[model samples]
Target: MFITSENATPVFKDLTLVMPAVAVGNVGQLAVDLLISTFNLPRVGYLHTDCLIPMAGNNPYATGKDDAGELHTAAEVYTAPELKLAVLQIRAPVVKSKSRRFRQLLLSWIKASGFSRTLVLSSSHAYQRDDQQLQGTPLRYLVTPSLLKTSGDAFKELGWREMEKRAPLCPERLDTGAEEERLYVPGGGITKGLYMDSCTEDVPLAVLLVFCSEGDNVPDAMALVSHLDDWLHLLDNPNREGKWKIPTSWNLLFGSGIPPAIF
Candidate 1:
């Protein structure tokens, strides 16, 4: 259920919704954090559901101790009305058994809200790339037919790479020769399933993803968001990396310094 922070539900019709996939390195989540901080978007509502683990904390985007005490939940929606953009920042991982339910919940909300399009920021394991994946840019994308109908020439103009489908290895059927290729995005939690589901549901959705590993992914987040800006034009001259603001919550991303006593 979506509960508004204000008394009235905000109108989201035709707004671009950007969300993250809890995948490898948490890159998508990190990128979303950047988007929220950069835009200084305000909290619109909460996507409260049991499909994700319950977690709560002080404001992750707080600038000081005074403002840090505000309560923030596992999943929240932020909005920048001027830009006609809405962002869903999910801080918790999905409950493995309820993954499908979570996806359904999201689709239902998107439909109800009447969003023009939805874009997911996600990442896959770079090391798992097949021979075909290793030859080009680490960034890739996937678009549902509904999005393609309206997004004609946009992706093509950007020179974006579509995620490659890999043929499964089946030695037993080597004589027959397997011709079917499958979308395999290892470490991309719910990304593949959600994308396929959106296709079937006729949802206008796009996924912008990167091939990355599980380690300091700040750079990966920056790169992903920058690419997204190219199409969305979230800010004037947003192509510059230095222009993006880093959130105060990211200060201790790796935790505190080592204790001198250990020496």
Candidate 2:
């Protein structure tokens, strides 16, 4: 269930919610990290449930050594009121059997909060793409009908590629009149399921994802954030002339230090 800190339950009405899928290369989560770090969003609350694998760690957005001891949960919420943006940074994978339940809880919260729209950042395996998907940029986007009506023009203006739809399986069957095109996201963890659920539930949602493989994906995260910056103008200087502030918590990303034995 979603729980807000006593003093952090600021109104989220009409705000945009951004979250990441624990997908291939963890690109989405890393990109979310960049946003949190760059904006220094403050923690608002966390989702408490058995759906996600239990995990905890030092706060990844802490600004000083004194704050380094703060513990962060697997699924935490952060907000930037100035931008009217709320982000859910998920650090662990959902338990397979409880995935559906988690999605339901999430949708419920989204509805109750009255967010105007939501964007999910995710990634898929590059090798799974068809020939056509390989012809252009690796980045792709998907928007529900409602969201398309509102933000479609902006996407077109940005020259963003819309994810391709595939013909439904068992095309041989003719009773259905015609084979409907379906969105397929192989290796995207909960991405496809969540997006489809949002569409069916009439939630105005957009999915922005990149095609990538396992291994070093920091570059992919950077590219994904840049793509988002084009749409949201999160960066003050769009020309890359300005510097972004990195969160001090990132200092412990690999670890505090190497072992003396290794040295």
Top lDDT hit:
1
Please provide TM-scores, in order, for all candidate models, with all chains considered together.
Answer: 0.95, 0.90
Colliding residue pairs in candidate 1:
none
Q: Among all windows of ten consecutive residues in candidate 1, which has the lowest summed lDDT?
A: 234-243
Candidate 1 lDDT by residue in tens digits, 1-263 = 89999988899998999999999999999999999998788999999899999999989889788989999999999998778999999999999999999999999999999999999999999999999899978999999999999896999999999999988766356664577787999999999999999999999999999999988999999999999998998867444454688998898899988999999
Model 1 TM-score relative to the real fold: 0.95
Best by TM-score: 1
Candidate 2 C-alpha lDDT tens digits along 36-127: 88877888899999999999988777766898899899999988878879999999999999888888899999999999899999999999
What residue runs in model 2 are displaced by over 4 Å at the alpha carbon? 167-180, 237-244, 248-263
At residue 250, give the lDDT of candidate 2: 53
State the lDDT at 182 in candidate 2. 69
